[model samples]
Target: MIKRAIALAAVLAALLTAFAVPAQAASGRYFYGVHAGLAGVRDYHGYVPSTYRPGTPMPLLVALHGCTENSFGFDLLTGFSALAEERGFIVVFPDQSTLANPAQCWNWPLPTNQHRGLGEPSLIAGITQKVRSQYTVDSARIYATGISAGAVMSGILGVTYPDVFAAVAMGAGCEYQCDILAQRDPDEQGRAGWREMGSRARSVPVLVFQGSADPVVPPATAGRVIEQWAQTDDLALDGADDGDIDAVAESVVRGSVPGGRTYTHSVYSGPGQGSVLELYMIDGAGHSYPGGCSCSLYGDPSGPDASGITWDFFLAHPRR
Candidate 1:
């Protein structure tokens, strides 16, 4: 049994290394480096727009990649860097070490990495702080977005580091402790997230995109995530789960990309805030980044423009 386990470990390590950290082609705006924080060291990449000035504070978006993907390739798949350049914001990509997870996943399922001031959450926050320190980042406009495992990690960050991340965008993923593999009650998972927030709890605007036909993550996962965030936000708003955020009526819109997939968009708003939560359910879409470049394995050219929608939502809702 020991020998078999060792062999399995070896194979997994090899597979992870195969797609680990490829050297990205040179781009003057794009840069890479390593950061060592209290938890550990991690590799990170940053994209600074050409219009950025030294003293000007621009919005910062932290993009986290899913399993089997790396920081260097996420932009290629999602076209986030291009959007950042056009929108005049700084974007950072925090890499996951293969040693941490054999599949290069963010380890969101592990309780050790779910809370504040511990594990992968700390490392990712450290990376975001490092970027803010180096670049002229608007603290109020800092946001996080990711896909799959990275999406789950983004939800965890919203709970554990609410002050650090003003809002979060998750694609093809579930909420914190929702555990797509285990499939628990979203309300319970949401309460757990609220507890994790502790005294730092606040309303963190969320943008979620889910594929209707996603095989790895069920379509119902989107509803689960929405429920979790609504519950968490409800508790955060008044320290009591009184159906505050949930009581607000959600506006739904149906649309489709030309010759692509159709989708349903839902927006949930707070009492004063325009929108605290937005969900996009893409019909017939698979477990891939919708409206992304098809160059990468996880990118799908069909469906709504998720990256664009996420940015618009992030821009609308800052740390207020």
Candidate 2:
């Protein structure tokens, strides 16, 4: 068992390579439509920035909206449209249907929907692949990020479809488990459902954002996500027996975002010092995307911009 674990870790570690982040968005065309998938249909709206050239491949970022929120509403709430227009990347917003959930939420908190090639994960992955095949996209530079329930779905994408995303950023989200958001399993294996879903992307990089004062989804919920990824990074690097960050952590960076949140940034190095897990604990913010607009529907505008922060993180990590 130990030998097999060591061999698998080495092979996965070798898969990480330096990636070049693209600049400038396309001026070609923007479209909104519905995609038919095995699970169901998903509505998506995308923007091709003005900075884009005709033939150059651009990075793709899939931004998911929270419950009761539509794609256009989330674009306003997070100012992602404005960022994409300036930063030069393709941004896709996938909307959840009321039929899936009465609140229009991604069914990520359910065990049935948590695995790969099934439920909402399959639908979203199909959309990502469709976008990649349609436009000039950097296949290795694809990424995902979301707020609240959307944030939870982003975690699911990172775990279940790492092959589709380079990395995932989650804000005020919980782990990829069934009912754990409202109920705790309390078992080691049960709590680590993230590891069980898929091992192909077991050590895929993760960026977490949690509001210290979030009212809707507290930092405790985000803590579970950070802890899960941190432990998975440990098991991948040195096996389950030595899964402890305090001892294996390569470095810890701590500071504040001007006058807003005093944040702690922890990085766990995988096989080649490739940073695999990161946590940003935002101080004094509500259940909204940090550094976002005063849109009120999704996040607090007085803080640092989550869009800019996420783009920077995604730029540094890519699937090999």
Candidate 3:
């Protein structure tokens, strides 16, 4: 059993190493969509690993872009496609509807937008379903991740569609605050809707990555989200600790979300998840992708390699 476990770990590590880090020469595809008879199309880019086969059920990762960026920007900045090529997974980068928000931001905080039947979350869920129908996807292994506003959307998805996504890696996002805001009586229906959606996220495993120095989303917001998720999962709370830091200088901290049968928390470095929830706190970073690389915008050269870390966390847990 020991030798078998060692071999499994080695295989999983190698798979993650090949697909989690950034690389060059990643391919992209554009998927056209027309929703509810709307005469418009959204662009989604798919990145498949070099070793992908037609019949194999590969995992899928959906990468969402931040405000002011499109699907293409997400592809250029995160370099996840390179990792997809190595890991033998399918990665889909969905473009936000410019018509909905001029800045292309996901309406994560709004209650109506968080629902499943209609709105952006539904659109995304539709996209995922469509992709699965067209490809050999391991439905149980589907995951999501994003930057800034995109991170918030990821949270919404985890909460709204707990069955669709196994885990989520949210970078620089926050919890659903509509309930608190609605206490002021802004919109009673909206508040109720938000709470309803929040209730749906009880089973999803989330790995949150936030930079302490991010100006867009305060680092404290990340902590609050971790706590919120912990409560939602009905897990006993454990204390927090610092995880690993990278050569670029970014650091991570983690706390446990107690499941009745298992204990799960974010780890800076270790084997993948056997527990329920994990949170990754990126220290001294900004609202950008990490690693020792340079880019035009939103790429921190002095931070830890986040792409690799995000993938590691995603691989550790499947949807439960």
TM-score of each: 0.89, 0.82, 0.72
lDDT of 3 by residue, 1-320 (tens): 99999899669645543443454543433344444313234556566676667789889999998998777567667777777776667888888877777999887766566666657777777778888888889888999888888987887777678778887888788764433332333223323323545535334567777776777777667655655554444321111112212111123334322321111134322213344455555556678765523653777655555678678777777664
Model 1, span 273-299: residue lDDT tens: 778888888999899999877768887
Better TM-score candidate (1, 3): 1
The numbered model that scores best in TM-score is 1
Question: Candidate 3, 3: how far from true, in Å?
Answer: 64
Range of the 10 consecutive residues with the lowest summed lDDT in candidate 2: 16-25
Name the better of 2 and 3 by lDDT: 2
The true-versus-predicted C-alpha distance at residue 185 of model 3, in Å, is 16
Candidate 3, clashing residue pairs? 49-85, 166-319
The lDDT per prediction is: 0.85, 0.72, 0.63
51 Cα displacement, candidate 2 (Å): 3.1
The backbone clash count of each candidate, in order, is: 0, 7, 2
